[model samples]
Target: MPLPSKRYVKVNVSQQFNYHTEAFNHLVKMLYPKRNTINKYDYLIDKHAFFTESQKQVISKTASSLCMLSEFYRDQDKFGNLYVTREDICNAIHILQRELDLQNRSLLLPPVLKWYAMQIQYHFGSDPFTLKQLRLQLGKSKSRVYDAVRELEHQKIVKLVGQRGHAHVFELVEHI
Candidate 1:
């Protein structure tokens, strides 16, 4: 072949692109074992006194933890009654599985989940379960129900609908 110009380079873009894909994937796997590097950095906030990437991540995670801990440890019901019963827990699990497109499988509920599930069920038509009703029906304390509601609310299966100091209203988001 005769050269048209000395500076002209015969580049086969498709062939080079194929090699680039392979090389890029290999390097990416080596650089990020979990392949979550991009998202991890994309959501990074700059409210920390750190310079390095690892330090930034540590500070960010720590801040997030503190925020969550404060919200969880508050004296009031943060969200609301989240638990219902075994069936309701199954409903939540089923809803989440559907949302995530996971395979469905029948299983027994955990004790804690059962407790919460009962909470949701016991107050199905009620704004909030009365302390007497909860104590009598579930054989548990008011504090236990309050904590269960907090835990379940965090899971998003239920919602606390009442304003502060009002008759507690718990809404089941997953069930009719």
Candidate 2:
């Protein structure tokens, strides 16, 4: 007998219904082969049959959200190269969530100080900015800006630079 042709059969997996079950069914059929029968689609689906219900759910959700046949599927770019991988997107999301958590945790400061911190990050980032310019740009009063900047300095998120007359220059500190 000749070798079996490896081909995947198109199965309609809907987002509204049991897409998780359908995907697992396909994966199961691929994992265990009949003794005398040739299973062609085995190569298409993932051979890992040791996944738990939760892991399977994660894969199914990822695949459906990404609009792919399975989580093991590799999407190609316009240049015919391997583009966005499932693991890549997951890693990016994890990183973004960590960043968000960091930002949220740093919100222990007052509301005005928090706003000032975000504004500083947006406007100057790591660069030095003058208090006069910040007050003018943010359209806030001089005393309010002064108080917020003082609170930020107290939190060690920013540090004062060289004093230019009554106006002070400051820059964001490291690791913030």
Candidate 3:
């Protein structure tokens, strides 16, 4: 049998205004794959029912800011695959929250403390952890980790729980 001529048709798959919701949802999924995280975002959005349109727009802008921050903090492996840890998401959220906090003009935590907070949230959840463990995990000097821990304590983000030998045990006041 004679072969038929081959043909190709190009379909545009670019995002459009009509696909805004889908795109937003996809971005949310990418940033927060966990059901609990998605629920948190949904709850925040649901609370905007009484907010003015401008305020709602600010929330959308914060979401975009989070996406950008997440990309900035993403790590890459030797194989070129990207990795976004819970720490990265937490850091992004903290940055966005600081930017959006009009009433509380307090400075955001230093990068080291932000990193520590995320690590605590990721590794220990609400449980207590020792400074020694954090130092080992971060591969930082003892003094450096101690200073960061002190800063966290000063900010009321973490509370000193107890002491084990020379190491100080602390627990997160709330998940960052």
Q: Please tell me which predicted candidate would have the highest TM-score against the true structure.
A: 3
TM-score of each: 0.33, 0.38, 0.39
Off by over 4 Å in 2: 1-105, 174-176
Candidate number with the higher lDDT (1 or 3): 3
Candidate topping lDDT: 3
Q: lDDT (0-100) at residue 53 of candidate 1?
A: 62
The list of candidate 3 runs beyond 4 A from truth reads 1-107
State each model's CA lDDT, in order: 0.44, 0.55, 0.59
- Ordered list by lDDT, greatest first: 3, 2, 1
- Candidate 1 lDDT, 91-147, residue by residue in tens: 333333322221211122346855566566655643455334555677778788777
**Tens-digit lDDT string for candidate 2 (1-176):** 99998698676533423455455546644553321112222222244444344544444333333333332455555543333344533433332222222333343455666778889888889988888888888999988888888877866688998777877889988433
Instruction: Give the range of the ten consecutive residues with the poorest summed lDDT in model 2.
Output: 35-44
Q: Kindly report the root-mean-square deviation of model 3 from the true structure over all alpha carbons.
A: 19.1
Off by over 4 Å in 1: 1-110, 122-136, 164-167
Rank the models by TM-score, top first.
Answer: 3, 2, 1
Q: Is candidate 2 or candidate 3 better by lDDT?
A: 3
List of clashing residue pairs for candidate 3: none
For every candidate in turn, the CA RMSD to the true structure comes to 21.3, 19.6, 19.1
